[model samples]
Target: MKGFESEMIQRLRTSDGWKFFGVLPQANRGLAVTWWVLLLLRGILPALFAIVIGRLVGAVQRGQDVVGPLALVGAVYLPLQILAPLHRAIGANLGSQTAAWLYDRLVLACVRPPGMGHLENPKLTNDLTMARDFDLGISGPPMSISMDFIASGLVEMIVGLASAAILVGYAWWAPLLLAGGWLATHWLLRESAVWRDRNTEEVRDAQRHADYAYRLAVEPFAAKELRLFGLADWTVDRFRSMRSRLVELRFQATKLRERPVLWSLLIVLIANIVVLGSMASAAADGSLALDRLVTYASAAVTTGMIAFGGLSWALDCSAAPVAAVLRLKEAMEPAGALVLGRQPADGLPAREIRFRNLTFTYPGTDQPVLEGFDLTIPAGTSLAIVGQNGAGKTTLAKLLCRLYDPQSGGIEIDGVDLRTIDLDAWRSRVTAVFQDFIRFELPLRDNVAPGGAPDDFIQSALADAGAAGLADLDTVLARGYEGGTDLSGGQWQRVALARALCAVRLGAGLVLLDEPTAQLDVRGEAEIFERILAATRQTTTILISHRFSTVRHADRICVLEAGRVVELGTHDALMAAGGRYHTMFVLQASRFGTEDTEEEGVNYDVLT
Candidate 1:
């Protein structure tokens, strides 16, 4: 006991060390008060009943009076017994509720958080995972400990003192013996808590193993691949190995905990044996009456409850970091405060959208994905960006839509720094649909209205996106769910298009489309390109595609490679120059529609 206490005192310095002590006070404050009030009945009434039993036996032996004492004990015992479960039940409900509140806060902190890119940080990710599981497992233990610790410790102390007081008549060492036993239990609890803290990571690892094994037992996505590739054995083996390693670590910690636990148990056993013998001797010697002897025995026996409860509290106090992690989340999240609403007025229209030596690299990335690239797109005009993989084609569209800010240089919308403007209002003015788009398992209306546009507005946008057939969303979407069906690739593409168009109709000034028809069939692709061309008439458009045929509808073409614009002009002008655009155009034209390369420039009078 002295050794363990010394170790804790030594460790009470660092942040982790501080938390162990700090959490003790924080957790105990109000809960300790409530627990103390509740635990009064657990020990007090039990001792009183034992006294009554002793009196009843004395009355039988002595032929005096026991009824008053027995009746008085019953009056207290019945109410205490009734209230025990009620208190426990209340703690149980509180445990579950606290867990739920923490879980909500944790998930919201991740999903709806400021610093949107924090998950990329390894430290934060590990903490988030720890906090999530903490909510799942920590609630019951701590709540039980808080309530029971006060109840059991108080009662046991009273009982142990009273019994020792009785045994004081026989030997002076009796009180010391009982105190040693009770204190030994507290020592064991302290040792167990220490090991639990030391092996916190190990417990998490074990749970991960169990969780991975459980996922293998269910989860639809893994089913096909697991069976087809015959990876089930490998997965099962992985799960087994992980589980075994975790169990081994925990077992090691548990082994370290054994000596203290054994010592406490041994102490209790010795105390009981000594207590029984001494009381018997006293009764035989007529130093105590038989009824009083029975009452003392009963009271001594009930001391175990107090000891058990106190032990539980001590051990649980060690691992309360699990709860602290949850509390951190509840405190760290912004709570939708400091969230400024949309800019009160509309933004200035984009004039010459300029990238003045703009440089950008993704979060945590090693190198710049875009470097010192300068370009301009005129207002009320369409620009087609063409490039091979990793040539920064899609990145341009992302930048144009302000999904990320440039790292070193700046982007100016009509010469206004995008960073200076309200981001919410800026986003509202632009819309985008990327190649890797979300396929929502929702009704057709919801699919088209992912931005939550009005119903009539969604219908109008769907018509514009060549999705009039899916406008009566409820029946069409419900049919798919009922029949275990989903929209075909072409059908889903149209739905996404509808969503984009809906955003456009909601007053988006710029619409960025990255590989808009990549999943569409040839006919669907043609139809989609025509609708996109029509869309450009209403909004300035930036198109990214590998298919050169799609650029015929674009008013201008810009060839990009390694994040720099190498060529810029109308389709005909670029083709006449016989550059990368010309070669790619001829290649795609040969594959799709007839390729036309001989031209000075596109006729300016087509739309006019």
Candidate 2:
């Protein structure tokens, strides 16, 4: 909790180095004005009480009537006390609601991006933690640094001055006592800041430890491996160690904070004692009148220094997550793919899609994924691209879709450069069903028409994809909110294939197939090819597959090697030429005769 407070303080402090709750701060004017008014009232009301009470006592001592007036003053005090609380609540509530709204907008802004790229840096991660922790009540920085808090703190300080002035008039030591209260608060915050900065890197390590514990204990994906390897016990041990180390680091940071606060508090205690003693001496010396003494006591009660100190402690608890959340907002604010307003994809002059002399590399990768790559899908035709694994087949699909742009060269859809057209507009006309296709737990009809319309043609798509007998399509879709009844790999592929067809029916003119049938049995593969041939009969298609049987039917076949297209021809032409395509076909077709399936280092090459 102490560590969270430190983080929260850092968050509330401006990037430009101004403190959030600094005396004479430049915060929201209305909130500031409201606070000063409330403080004036709080300070004035208490002094009024002391003055009235003292007068009543003075009159009664003189044997004059005092009951009626004292009763009236007491009545006013009750409502005034209630108003102070109501005012604080109103301001705090207003500030909290505003903060929540800002947090939500920041989250949605980050979410608009195509990927969570902003989370790559430490500053952003730390800032988010600050924002999150601060939003909590008296527990965190958000609560402490909020507009209401700023108002309240300033109000309290002003009221403290009322008490300070009263003490200073009768005793020189009273000024020192009030100064000591501020000194304690100020020194405590400064020490906290120092420890906060010192432990930031360690806190990150602690965060990672916490994250690992969360994954081990809660995430479902790791449960299988953990259970299979008898690792649940070992993981529990690891979590315990990480948690213990994190707690120790937090404790050390907290101790650094506590020392300064304790020393400052000691100084304040001494200052108050000296002031109290001086006031007593002045009264005994006849310099202090009883009526005046009562007034000063009322003013002293007005300060609420004890409440301030307690509030400071409570504020830290809420500030940790609030600070984290704010930091997250800062990080989230600038990251993600920018989406411009929608554009119409129609009237593109050329129908062909071409990649010319394209060379590409992923960020953080040294080896080029695509080297001077060139490929073209002509207007209204099918093109088969065959490649060995890791030969950049899938990378080409990503580039084509503009999930990424190439490092050099460019892709042209028709004659217009891909860079010039609207991305979402271009993407809309193209559809893809990857090997790792999504199996949405939506209704069967909705899944087939996932990105398109749910219309009467749902039956046709399912029948085409070979899930025709899986029960009534609508009934199958309805059966499972429970992971959608768990489709077999082949069945899911068929569903994905149907989804692509529905996309075509809804006006998608081009489709990219990325190993769309890798999981299918031979019979299923045959059915898939027939479906593809039918779907692409009228639209352009770029087919990516390892099966020569699938590629042989395309109007054109292009072979890729080391990120370059090494061969392009009709399947029959390549076969007759007896080069790479012909050689690979013969080799792969020969695999059926082997008793064991060959993997990566296998020596079952037909040529060998």
Model 2, span 1-608: residue lDDT tens: 99999998886674212322332223245654665566568655655676677777667766787787588678758857786776677566545554665467457655655434454444465455444433643123454245545555545655565556656656666665655665565556544445453236676567566556756877887999999999988888888888778777766665545555567667666666666666667678978777666766665555435335223332333333444554555555455353343446773323688889999776445688899988877877888888788888888887777666677898777766777777777777778988778766667777888655755677777777777766455544434465446677777888888888777777778888997877787556766777878866878888888876667778999988999999999998999999998889778866765533332212322322
Choose the strongest candidate by TM-score: 1
TM-scores of all predicted structures: 0.73, 0.72
How far residue 347's Cα lies from its native spot in candidate 1, in Å, is 4.1
Cand. 1 TM to true fold: 0.73
Clashes of each: 2, 39
Identify the candidate with maximal lDDT: 2
Give per-residue CA lDDT, model 1, range 156-264, as digits (tens): 6655555555545445776567656766675565453554443365565565566667578568769999999998888888778776776676566555454656777
After superposition, candidate 2 runs with Cα above 4 Å error:
1-100, 111-173, 195-205, 257-262, 294-344, 347-351, 361-368, 382-393, 434-446, 450-454, 468-494, 515-522, 543-608
Shift in Å, residue 277, candidate 1: 4.7
